[model samples]
Every structure is written in structure tokens, then in C-alpha cells.
Target: MEDAYTHKDLAALCSVSETTIKSYRRKFPGFIPVLTRGKPIRFRKEAGEVCLKIRDCFEKGMSVNETLAELGKHFTPRTGAAPSPSPSPARSQQVVSPEYLDKFFETAGKMMQGMAALATAQAKAGQRLEKVEAVLDKLLEIEARNGERFNELLTKVGSPSPDIPPTASSSGDGAPSRETVRARKIVNVRGSEGEVRSYALEKEADKATGGLEQPPGSLLSTPIVIRNDQDEFLGVPGRLPLSGFVEILVREAEEDGASLSRWERAGEAWVFVMDLTGGGSHALYFTATTTPRGNQVALLERLDVDGKETTPQFLQEFFRQVKDKV
Candidate 1:
């Protein structure tokens, strides 16, 4: 006769904590046969195999929902064997043969190797596709704005004030604009090879000042502000006194349940890889400094997933918040 196992047994078989097993059970209700849900929850003998499958999917980096879906594809209910005399305790202890164990390990190894190769190929293809799309979109935008941009340049050139010489540092209105003079070039680096991400900055009318546009956080005083893909705020980014604002971001992410997978200093800037608890990961590059010029934290790219996601759309709101705080 087969022996049913308790939650503790299943946890041990799956090599996961009891709490993790409970979470999986909640996610995949009815997948496991629960004999009882009292003080010590028990499961049918067949639930052991299901637990193993769950563990495999998680180890392969599949999300909880994805794991459940994948397992559901090949799930089969257990059927009891024909009635027979119970085996001796010593005989029952010998479950798997050496040949079977060796075969299982060999197959698992091949599957993992194939999966790694496939994942690498897919990631590279996706990154290349994203870069191409970004470049095409930028070209189309520049083509569309050629007329208006040319007119603006002509206006700036034609209407220069005779009293105030039109130097490179001075704005067209004869005022020295901080944006034009203090703006720094930020390069977006991405992909496994980590090539420099480059694209044209299209002309946009500033809604706040009703004039020329500025960088994402140019008008704000805070070190950084974060927002989701839908332009919703995800709380303000961390700030430090002198330097190491990047360290503050890492600490804040840990506090918020995000795992810091990769972090490294790149020249004068920094790159961070964060794995969100909700699933998916993001690569962020930024530069923060309190220099003789001023305090500035510049985000190089709009936080994007698959090339298009949450952009830094809260610049106006950030400026408003800083003004209110002051």
C-alpha cells in the first residue's frame, strides 16, 4: 500500500519551506490532494510528484502563475494500484533504482542546457528588436518635426536682440537659460554586450513654461522621482547627503522587497539590475552628483519593459511637489 505524506513530508521532498509550500498551494488550489487541513495538513501520496514539478519550475525561474500553468498542461490524477499485501518496511525503503536516478539526472541536465541557450537567444533578439524600433520611431518623429523645428531655429536666428549678442550660452530671448547651458549628455547603455543606447531627442513644446522643453528632471530640485509605466508614482527615489545615492536606492529597494541582482559603477555613472517581487527585472542607469554646478540626478532612459513602458512623465508634478515642500 502507498503511504500518504503530510505537508512537512512534501516540503522536505520539494526542498522548500512550509510557508513556501502553503503559498504554492494557495496559488494552485485543487492541484494537490489534501487529505486534511487541520493542525498538520496532510497530502495524498501522489502530491509528492506535483511538489517536485513545482520545485523544478521555480528553480527554472518560472513565476508562480507560469509554473501553475505549465504544470496544468500535463497534470494527471493519481490512480491507486490493484489491492495487494503491504510491502515490508525494508522493501518499501528501496524506491528508485540507480539506473532510473542516473537517467533522470541526465535528462534534467540536457533540459537545463537547452533552456539556458534558448533564454540567451531570446534576450538578445528582444534587445535588438527594441533598439531597431526605437531608432525607427525617432527617425519618423524627426521627419515629422522637420518643418516646425526649422521654423523655430529660424525664429531664434532671425529675431536675435541687437542689444544682447546671441552667444552660445544665451537663450534666444537674451536670457541665459539654465536648461540649455547646464544640460548634460546622458548615454543609455543596454543589452548583454552593453552597447551605448543612442537616439534623437525630438522637439517638444514645454507645457509648464509654454516655451522650450527641458530634460526629464531638469525643473525639479529633488535627486530623483520614480513612476510606473502608466505614469503613476512609485514613491520618491532615495537621496544621500554627499555621494552614494545609488547605495540609498539599493537599500530602499531591499526595504520594498525588491532584490538587487546586479550593481556596478560604470565610469562616472552607475548601472543597477533590480528584480521586482511582482516578477520581471529592470536595468537602470543614472548619474547623481552635488557638484559646483548644482545638485542633479539625471535618468538616462525612460524605465521601459520590452522597449516601451513607464516613461519619466512626472517632471511637472515633481517640480510642483518641490515647490510646495519649499
Candidate 2:
């Protein structure tokens, strides 16, 4: 009787993991013949040689198709037992070999096991898919409810309040006065250090105005005033090309002893990475959008200091200096 080797024996011989040997058997099923199909299945002794050859081929970076071609040169692939010749009429009484019957039953059992495993996997996959779909449906329902509530709130905000009496200036024309318009109270403001406080906005405003109150009629008469406090950083002209503006900023930063590490286009924005002389880094993202006049304007969308999302005071000063040169 020919000796056969188990998966472990072959794995030890090849200096490879047992899992790797199993994978090889699965990948080149024809090359590795099973001598006995049972617990710790046994393969023909020649299978070890085939496994070593496969390992060598893999180490050489040969593709599966290339390995298959190479394997065909030295080994005869097992294509299963040839069909028995038809019994001659003169000698019709032929006894079936017990060994052949055993082999037949083992192969059939393997097939049945494979089919059972496949059915189990498919059932588990279907259950997981149903769970995912249920979660998505719930999320969509929540999103729809939130959208409806938001719209209702917007409508309430835009409409004039019936509780407040109409002023003399608005009573004759039946139009809402400026005071009648909803003023969105500042609920919270987040600072550069990520601290959130309700008084932060007022405190910052006081600091900017040196705690002085604006005299009546001295302020702008417009309903809304878009302040240009950081005009040096944000006062880019609409007519200027965004690329040219970026180049100017880069030159200014370089002249200030800061070196640009790299720059790249991220979607519709240009990202600039810079290395500061004080052993730190910063990234600035500049995005361009078309105005109603069909002119492009560049806006600084985001700033990062040393890979963290923060707006340090030094960065503000740096940009102010850059702006002077621009």
C-alpha cells in the first residue's frame, strides 16, 4: 500500500502554515489528490512535492494561470477515476471492489458536507442583509421627520408674530417692521480652543469695539451688515484668478521664512501645506465659487495648525502680513 501524508505532515515538510497548505489544496484541487476523505484528511504522498512546487512558483511571483501551466509540465493532474469498461456479455458476473465502494461513499459525503455549508452561509448572509435594510429604513424615516420639523420651524420664523402689536411705521402700510423680523439669538459660540460658551460672541464683540457703544444713526442703515474684520485674508477681488491669488500668498509666505511643503487640488478647493520656521506645520484650504455677477471669488474655507483643527492667533497675524505683500 502506498503511504499518504496528512495536511500537518505536508505543512511541516514545506515549512508553511497548515492554513496555507489547505489554501493550496483548494486552489489546485486537481494537483493535490485526496487518498482518504475523513477527519485530518490524507492526501497522496506526491501532494507534498506538488505543494513545494506551488510554494516555489508563488515565491517567484508566478500567477495562478502561470503556475497551472508549469504544473502541467511535471505532474499528471487527477481528473477522477476513469469509467469502468462495459462488462462483456460472456463474463457478465463481475464483483465490485470493496475499496472502490468505500472511495465512492467518501467522495459523496464530501459533496454533501460542502452543500450543507454553502446553504448555512447563504442563510446567514440573508439575515444580515435584512438587518442592514431595516437600519437604513429607520434612518430614512428619522431624516424625513427631521426635515419636516425644520421646514415648519423656518416657516414660523419667517412669518410675523401676532403677539407683538404693529408699530406706527408699519401699521399704515400693513408691512412688517424691522423689529418684527425674527432676530436669531446667539445660543452658543465655539472658540479656537473648542470651548463653547453663550457669552463668547458678546465678549468677542466687546473686545473688538473696545467696550464702546455705537451712537444712534452712526451705524449702517442696512438691515444686515457683513463685517470685514479679516479683510486682509478674505478681501480677495472676484476678478482675480484663484490660482494667481494662491501663488501670491505662497510667495508672501516664503518670503516670511515659511516654506511650502506641498499643494494639491482637493475637489473644487486648493490645499496648501506649509512648514513654519518655529518647527510646526499648517494647512489652508482655498475654495472658489461663482458670484451672481459670474465672477469667481476665492474664500479661505478651513485652517489647520500642526494637523489639528484650530485657528491660533499667530496664524491671523501671519495672514495679515501676507496680505500686506499681496
Winner by TM-score: 2
Backbone clash numbers for all candidates listed: 1, 0
When summed lDDT is taken over every stretch of 10 residues in candidate 1, the lowest stretch is: 213-222
What TM-score would every model get versus the actual structure? 0.23, 0.25
State the displacement of the C-alpha of residue 19, model 1, in Å, after optimal TM-score superposition: 0.8
lDDT of each: 0.54, 0.60
- State the TM-score for model 1: 0.23
RMSD of model 1 against the true structure: 26.8
Which structure among the candidates has the greatest lDDT? 2
RMSD, every candidate, angstroms: 26.8, 23.0
